[model samples]
Target: MAFWTYMLKCADGHFYVGHSDNLEARIAAHQSGTIGGYTHSRRPLELVWCETFGSREEALAAERQIKGWSRAKKRALIAGDWDLISELARCRSRG
Candidate 1:
C-alpha cells in the first residue's frame, strides 16, 4: 500500500501537514471537520500538495520534516520550486 504526505491550506491561510495510507478519506475528514483539531477549527481547507511514498515510515518522515519547515519553504514546495527549496535549506543551515 502506498502512503502519502499531504499539505492543506487552511482558512486562516496557514498550512497543515499530515500523512496517511488513505489520502482521500483523510482529506475528507479534515474538510468535514471530523478530523477534530487544528484543521478542524481552521475549516474550509484546500489540498495544496501531496507526495506518495512506498512505506508508511517514509510518508511519516516526510510529514514530520515538512512540519518543521518555514512557511516560505512550504510554499516553495507547494509551487514545485525545487531551486527555492534547496536555497531555503541552505539558508536555514546558515542561520
Candidate 2:
C-alpha cells in the first residue's frame, strides 16, 4: 500500500496539504465536497504537487511539515525550486 503527501491549490488561491493512502479517492472526495472540511468550501481544487511515501507515517510527516511552511515556500515547492526553498528555509530560521 502506498501513502501519499499531496498539496492542492484551492479555488480561493490557498493551498491545502494532506496525506492519504488513497490519493485518487481522497482527491475525488475533496472535489465532490463529500469530505466536508477546509477543502469542502474551497472546492474546485487543483492538485499542484504530490509525493509517494513508503509509509503512512512518512506521508503524515511530510504533510505536517508542508502545512507549517510559508506560502512562498509552498509556492517554491510547487514550482520545484529547490534552491529557493532552501533559501526560504534559511531566511525563516534566521528570523
Candidate 3:
C-alpha cells in the first residue's frame, strides 16, 4: 500500500502537515469540516505539497520531521524551492 505525507496551505496562511494512505479522502474530510483541530480552525485548505512513500512508517517519519521544521523551511518545501532546501540542508550539517 502507498502512504503520503502532505502539506496543506491553510486559510490563515499557515500550513498543516498530515499523513494518509488515501489522499483524496483525507482532503475531502478536511474540506467538508469533518475533521477537527488545527486544520478545522483554518478551513478551505489547499494541497500545497505531497510526497508518496512505500510504507506508513516512512510517511509518518516524514510528517514528524516536517512538523518539527521551522515555518520558513516548511514554506520552502511547499514552494519546491530546492535551492533553499539545499541551503537549509547544508546549514544543518554545519557546526
Candidate 4:
C-alpha cells in the first residue's frame, strides 16, 4: 500500500502532520468533519504539503519528525523552501 505524510494548514495559521495509507480518502474525511478531534475544532483545513513513502513506517516516522518542527519550519516546508528545509534538517542532525 502507498503511504503518505501530509500537512494541513489550519484556521489558526498552524500546521498539522499526519500519515495515512489512503491520502485522498483521509483528506476527504477530514474535510467532511468526519475526522473529529483537534482538527475538528479547526475545520476547513487546507492541504499544503504531502510526500509519498514506500512504507508505512517511513511515513509515520516523517510525521513524527515533522510534528516537532516550529511553525516557521513547517511553513518553509509548505512553501517548498528546499534551502531552509535542508538547513533545518542539517541543524537537527548536529543537535
Candidate 5:
C-alpha cells in the first residue's frame, strides 16, 4: 500500500500539510469540507505539492516535518528548490 504526503494551498494563502493512505479520497474530503478543521474554512484549496511514500510512517514523518517548516522553506519545497531549502535550513540552524 502506498502512502502520500501532500500540501494544499488554501484560500487564505496559507498551506496545509497532511498524509494519507488514500490520497484522492482524503483530498476530496478536504475540498468538500467533510474533513473539517483548518482546511474546512480555508476552502477552495489547490494541491501544490505531493510525494508518495512506501509506508504510513514515512508519509506521516514528512507531514510533521513540513508542518514545522517556515513559510519560505515550505515555498522552496513546493517550488522544488532543494538548494534554497538547504540554505534556509542552514540559516535557521545558525540563528
Candidate 6:
C-alpha cells in the first residue's frame, strides 16, 4: 500500500502536515471535522500538497520533517520552489 505525506492549508491560513495510508479517507475525515484534533477546529482545509511514499515509515518521516519547517519553507515546498527550499535550508543551518 502506498503511504502519503500530505499538507493541508487550514482555514486560519496555517499549514498542517500529516501522513496516512488512506489519503482520500483521511482527507474526508479532516474535511468533515470528524478527525477531532487540530485540523478539526481549523475547519475548512485545503489539501495543498501530497506525495506518495513506498512505506509508512518514509511518509511519517517526511511528515515529521515538514512539521518542523518554518512557514516560509513549507510555502516554498507547496509552491514547488526547490531553489527557494534549498536556500531556506541553507539559511536555517547557518543561523
Candidate topping lDDT: 5
Residue pairs with colliding backbones in model 4 are none
Clashing pairs for model 2 are none
Off-target runs (Cα >4 Å) in candidate 2 are none
* Candidate 1 residue 35 C-alpha distance from true site, Å: 1.0
Candidate 4 lDDT tens digits, 11-83: 8876889999999999888888899887887888999999999999999999999999877789888899989
State which candidate has the highest TM-score: 5
Model 5 per-residue lDDT tens digits across residues 5-85: 999999999999999999999999999999979999999999999999999999999999999999999999999999999
Candidate 6 regions exceeding 4 Å error are: none
lDDT of 5 at 27: 96
Clash pairs, model 6 backbone: none
Q: Write the per-residue lDDT of candidate 1 for residues 1-95, one digit (tens) a residue.
A: 99999999999999999999999999999998888878988989999999999999999999999999999999999999999999999999999
Per-candidate TM equals: 0.98, 0.98, 0.90, 0.87, 0.98, 0.98
lDDT of each: 0.96, 0.97, 0.93, 0.90, 0.97, 0.96
Q: Clashes in model 3: which pairs? A: none
Off by over 4 Å in 1: none
| Clash numbers, per candidate | 0, 0, 0, 0, 0, 0
Worst 10-residue lDDT window, candidate 3: 86-95
Q: Is candidate 1 or candidate 6 better by lDDT?
A: 1
Give the per-residue Cα lDDT of candidate 5 at 51: 100
Cα lDDT tens digits for candidate 2, 22-88: 9999999999999988999998999999999999999999999999999999999999999999999
User: By lDDT, is 2 or 6 better?
Assistant: 2
